[model samples]
Target: MGQLLVVRHGQASFGADDYDVLSPTGEEQARVLGAALADLAPDLVVHGSLVRQRRTAELLAAAAGWDVRLREDPRWNELEDLAQFAAVSGSPDGLDRDGFQQWYDAAMARWTGGEHDHDYSEPFVGFRDRANAALADVADEGTVVAVSSGGPIAAIASVLLAGDATTYGRLLPGIVNAGITRVISGRRGLTLLSFNEHQHLPPELRTYR
Candidate 1:
C-alpha cells in the first residue's frame, strides 16, 4: 500500500501586493508541521510551482532535517485565481475580504454549475481531472507528501468522495492553512483516509484564506 499526504500551503499574503508569497505566520506554520512530521520522514516531497507552495515544501523539508530533493509539479497547481474568478462572476469594485469571499463563493458556484463552461478558460471539470491525474502519477509504494493549495486539494477530495468534481467548491472554505489530508492506495484503489487534519497547529495558527 502507498500513502499520499497532501498539505494545503500555509497562510499566504491575502491582502498583500503579491498573494503568492507566504506571510510570517505561514512560515511558522510550515516549520511547526515539519517538526511534527519529522518522524514520518516522507519518501518524497512534492509541491506545486507556485511560490508559496514551493516555499512551504522547502521550509518543511529543512525543518524536518530531510535531505530529499523537492519535486516541482505544475499539475499540483491551484485552480483559484482570485481576481480572474471574481471578475467572471461580476464582482463589484472595492470588495473587502468578506465581500470578496461572498463574490468568490458565487463565482465558484457559477463556474462549476455546468451552465457557463464557456466563461472559464479551464472549466471546473478540467481542473479536477488534472489534479486527479497528478495524484495518480505520484502514487507509489512509499509515503509521499505533496504541498498544494486548497482548490486542488478539495478538488481531489471531492472526486474521491463524491465521485466527481461538481461539489469541490463547497469543500474549499473549510480547508485551513497548512491542513493535512491523507489518501491511501490499496487493492480498492485510492481511498480517502482523512481530510483537513490540523491538530498540529495551535488556535492562533489555524487560518483559512
Candidate 2:
C-alpha cells in the first residue's frame, strides 16, 4: 500500500498575459509547502508538463533539499476545452476573463452531463481513464506526490468520491490554490484521506489570483 498526495500548483498569474507562470508569492507558497513536507520524504514526485505546475514542483523539491527527479505526465494537465471554446467564440486576447469563465462553466456542465464527445476535448471518461491509469502506475510502497492543476485534481477527487461526473462540477470550485489532498492505497483500492488542505498556509498566501 502507498500514499498519494495531490497538490494543486501554487498561485499563477491569473488574468495575465500568460497564465502558465507562477507568481512570486506562488513560489514562496511552494517553498513553504515543501518545508511542510520535508519530513515525509516522498519516494516519487510527479507533475504535469505545464510550466506553472513544473515550477511549483521544482520549488518544493528545492525547499526540501532533495534532488528532484520529476516525471511529466500530460494526463495530469487541466482541461483544454475552455481554451478551445474561447477560440471558437472569437474571444479577444487578454480581456475575456468573464467570457472565458462563462464558456468554461457551460463546457464543464456539458462535459459532466455527457453531452460532449471526445472530439470536443478530453471527455470526462477519457480524463478518468488516463488519470486512473497514472494513479495505478504510481501506487506502490512509498508516498507519491503529484502536482497538477485544479481541473485534474478535482477529477481525481471526484473519482475517489465514488460519485457521478456531476459531483465534480460541484466540488471543483472549493479547491484552493496550492491545496493538498491525500489518498491512500490499500487492499481494496485507493481511499481518499483528505481533500483540499491548506492549513499550512496563511491567508495571504492562499490567494488563487
Candidate 3:
C-alpha cells in the first residue's frame, strides 16, 4: 500500500484584511510538522494554489530539506466563495470570530445541502469531485505529501469514509492548523488512515481558523 500524506495548511490571517497569507504561528507550525515528518523522505510535494497553502508547502519542504520541487494544483484549493457565503448567511457589518463561525456553519450547511447550487460558483459536489480527482492523481507510488485547505481535505476524507456530505461537515471545523491526515491506497482502494493529526505541534501552535 502506498501512503499519501495530506497536510492542512497552517492558520491564515483570520482577522487581517488579507486572509490568504499565513500567520506567524502558522509558519512555526509548518516548520514543526516538517521536522516531525523528516524521516519519511517524500518523493513529491504538492499544494493548493492559495497563498497559505503554497507558503506552507515551501516552508515545510525547506524545513524537511526535501529536494523535490513543489507542485501546484488548484483542485486542492479551498472552497473559496466567501462572498457567496456572506450573502447566503446575511453577514452583518462586522463579524467576530464566533459570529463568523456561526454564519459560516450555516452557510456551509446550505452549500452542502444541494439546494442552493445556483448560489455558489462551484457547488459542493463539484468541489468534492475535484478534490477526489486531485487525491487520485497524487496517490501514486512513493510517499506523496500534499498541502491543502480544510474544506478539500475534509471532502476527500468524507467521500472515502462514508460518501456523505454530513461526514464532510463533521470533519471540517476541527481540522487543526498544519494538521496531518494519512490515506493508504491498497487492494481495497483508498482508506483513511488518519485525520487531523497534530501531535507534532506544541500546544500554543495548535489553531483552527
Give all candidate RMSDs, comma-separated: 1.5, 2.1, 1.4
Candidate 3: regions farther than 4 A off: none
lDDT of 3 by residue, 90-165 (tens): 8645877788777777888899999989888899999999999999987765689999999999999999887699
For each candidate, the alpha-carbon lDDT, in order, equals 0.87, 0.81, 0.89
- What is the overall TM-score of model 2 with all chains considered together? 0.90
lDDT of 2 by residue, 1-209 (tens): 79999999998987689988998888998999998888877888998888999999999988988765689987778767556555434444565678667767775666666654544556678876787777777888478999988877778888888877877787788787788989999888899899999998988888754
Q: Per model, how many backbone clashes are there?
A: 0, 0, 0
Tens-digit lDDT string for candidate 1 (1-209): 99999999989998798999999999999999899888886789999999999999999888888888689999899976655575576755698878876887677777877788877878888888899998998887378999999989998999889655456766888999989999998888898999999999999999997
Arranged by lDDT with the best first, the candidates are: 3, 1, 2
Clashes of 1: 0
lDDT of 1 at 1: 90
Could you tell me every candidate's TM-score relative to the true structure?
0.94, 0.90, 0.95
